[model samples]
Target: MESDSAYRSRVRSWLDDNLSGRFAHLRGLGGPGREHEAFGERIEWERHLAAAGFTCVGWPPEHGGQGATLQQQVIFYEEYARAGAPATVSHMGQELLGPTLIEFGTPAQQKRFLPGIKNVTELWCQGYSEPGAGSDLASVATTAVRDGDEWVITGQKVWTSLAHVADWCFVIARTEPGSKRHRGLSYLLVPMKQPGVEVRPIKQLTGTSEFNEVFFDGARTAADCIVGEPGEGWRVAMGTLAFERGIATLGKQIGFRRELDAVIGEAKATGAYDDAAVRSAIARACVRLDVMRAYALRSLGNADAGTAAASKLLWSNWHRDLGDLAMMVRGASGLTVGEGYDLDDWQRLYLFTRADTIYGGSNEVQRNVIAERVLQLPREVRQ
Candidate 1:
């Protein structure tokens, strides 16, 4: 195996060379709340990355990846961020669902799904959250029943990121009648373009519609689409969640540093840097970012539930706080937008990070995981 430095060099060289010409315009485009920017163009750029073997760097080579070591994967993300490459459109497929499928999926299932994900031919959205079951995933109320060779699905999923453009969704639905909570649930792969599936965009504060509410009315998929046994969906879904909080987040830390530097630059220009409070906040943000990086590095490949939960709490809160700091740097002007409600990048960051602590897994949920699972405290009472 090549050294980590050699891998980093290779990744940096590729991104620097490729993110030019027609794709040059996409530098720094698309992210958390900005997924709507250059929607079609970003997908094309991601395909370029996939062709270059940049996407899914950590997966084994036989699965259409570089089989990159965890360190090399971290290096890839760091270089990708440093090059100002646009955020990937295939994260749900490449990061979360692909890993889950590799772990729990049958050979036939892997063959059917992995190639599309690797080539960016089929984008995927997660159908785990609903209006009632955002973080408490065990309470997913969607239902899928076997009919002939297919499972008919009927339910609604809310806050599904990028469902508007996704070709598929990995859904958690109850497959057994009279079953409650985590029991009798199954992880099924469902197609999004079917007549039975409807995607309605949900506009966010950033005025982008990346999140969607999807309705499944008799949507159908082959019975072989299930990842694990029918009653074991909860376990499979948990594996996806663990992968969701994996090392890919290191790239986000670099983005945070960029945002912080921009805020500091704004502070200097606006004379806000002279204020002791603003200066102190800048210092704290810098220190917290370093700490988060270290913590993320330490927790890499450690899938312990408590560790993942704590990692989420650490980065989400720090990012949400960074948003607050950006607002502080902007002072009064931050409150207003242009005539067409055009927001500057700082303004968008402030508005978007508001949901950081709430989405994925909320702060409360992370605390519960730490408290009950790690500390062995009594589990929170659920009605």
Candidate 2:
């Protein structure tokens, strides 16, 4: 096995060489209002990463990966974020579904799905949150009933990101109707190209349809499509959520901090730095960014040691604060979009940050986990 520093050096060198020329144009491919072309570019970029054996760095070599260590995978993400590489189009598949499959999927299941996912040949969307089940995913009412060899699925999922473009959906449905909220659920990998599955864009306040509401009426999948054992979907879903809260969010912290620095530079150029109050706010933002970075590193250390959870709460809180500070620094200009004073990114980010608190197991619930699991505090009683 190679040393961690050696692996980092190797990945960094590969990115510097392969991503220096035309690849540089791939940066920011999926920013606001450019989803279609950006999606196509991202697919091409994933092909490049797959060809270089960097698409799923930590996955086993037999599964279209280089069989790198977890640290090596982290190095790839950190270096790519620094290089400002285009965002992956298969984020839902690679980050959440792929890991869940690795944990609970059968050998056949892995062999069938891993390659397409790693190569971004079949994009995926998550079907967890519904109109009624937003943060309370356990309340998902989507039903999947056995009908011979096929399971008929019906219901609607709201706030499904990228469903309109996805070729597959990792759907969590209530398989046993009479069971309690968290039980009787089964996760199914449903193909999105089939009939009876409809995706309607849900425009955000930023005027982007990055998310959608998906309706499934008599949608069907083979029984083999179930992930893990029946009624174990909740556990599998939790594992995916843990990955989302742990590694996925950590990968973006450094990039967000870098953006914060750019915001500071913009403020200085605009003479906002001369104001004592603005200077104080920027200084406070810098401190928070540093804290977020430290928490991210600490989370990585815990992941290496196989003990990671407390960092989720820290990250959730700090991310909200960082966005608030950015909006404050941008001031009145933050309200507008599209280029004027670089406010487009700031405004879009501000709107998107509103969802940050809600997704990946809401910050309120994360705090409860931290209090009970990390701090061993008494739980609050509900009247």
Candidate 3:
């Protein structure tokens, strides 16, 4: 086993050597609301990372990954973020779906999908959120019915991140009629680029469309594409959620740290550091971020639902608050955009973080999960 320092050194060295030349300009180009920046170039850069065996480092060696230990995976992500490597275009596949497939997918399914993810040959999007189902995934209304060897799907998935560019979608749809809430759902791997599917971009406050509304009039996939037994998808879907909030979060925190540092730099540049309140806010952001780091490191690999929910609450509020501070630092100047409505990093950061508490899981929902599941309090009433 490589020592942690050695692993970190190796990752840093690799990033230093590779993230130059044509890719030199791409550092810190894509993330959050800025997904429109140099996107095609970022895809090329990701393929370069993939070709060098740096992608999907956590999966076992059998699954086309380096089979890196959890600590090493953290080191890689930290180094990657620290290096300002562009935000990956294949996160849905490399981070969420790949691990889910490894855990619950059939051997055949793993064989069919893992390589594409590792190599960045195929991009994926999550089809779990719907017009009505966002965080309440159990209320998914999209339906899939078996037709001979194929499953015909019909429904709409809204706020689907990267759906316009995805070649496949891991969907949670109502597979059994009369099924309610969490029961009778199936996790199906459906392909995009078919006549049955239409992707319409939903404009965001950032003036970008990183997510989309996908209409599945009659999309079809092989019946064998289901991840688990029919009507047992709730379990498999939860497994994917577990993966969704895993070791990769530490890397995300590293990105948060970078964003925070940028905000601090902006404060100094704009003379906001002169204000006692602004200085205190900045200090509080730094201290809270450190606390978040400590909590994440402590909770690594634990997967307690309460801990996960708490972590989400901490980071989401912190990021949104950072956005608020960014605008505060700029004062009235942050309100205006360039002639083309182009926003600088600070403005973009401020606008984008407004949704931080809303997406993934809302702050309200996280509090509810903590109240009922963590505190063992009475559950909130629902209609």
C-alpha RMSD of each candidate structure in angstroms:
0.8, 3.0, 1.0
Residue 180, candidate 3: alpha-carbon lDDT: 98
lDDT of 3 at 213: 96
Winner by TM-score between candidate 3 and candidate 2: 3
Clashing pairs in 2: none
- Predicted candidate 1 versus true structure: per-residue lDDT over 224-312, tens digit per residue: 99999998999999899999999889988998888889899999999999999999999998998999999999888899899999989
Better of 1 and 2 by TM-score: 1
Query: What are the runs in model 1 whose C-alpha is more than 4 Å off?
Result: none
Error of 1 at 246 (Å): 0.6
Question: Which digits, one per residue and each the tens of the lDDT, describe model 2 over residues 226-252?
Answer: 999889899888887766655555567
- lDDT for position 122 in model 2: 88
- Residue pairs in collision within model 1: none
Q: Total clashes, candidate 2?
A: 0
Q: How close is candidate 2 to the true structure, as a TM-score?
A: 0.90
Q: lDDT by residue for model 3 over 1-383, one digit each (tens)?
A: 88999989998998999999999999988887878889899999999998888999999988989889889988998899889899999999998999999989999999999999999999999998887988888889999999999999999999888898899999999999999988999999999989899999999988899989999999999999999999988898878777777888888888999888888888898788899999999999999999998998998887777888898899989999999999999999999999888888888888889998877878898899999998999988889
TM-score of each prediction: 0.99, 0.90, 0.98
Instruction: List where candidate 2 sits over 4 angstroms from the true fold.
Output: 31-37, 301-310, 336-343, 375-383
Instruction: Report the backbone clash tally of model 3.
Output: 0
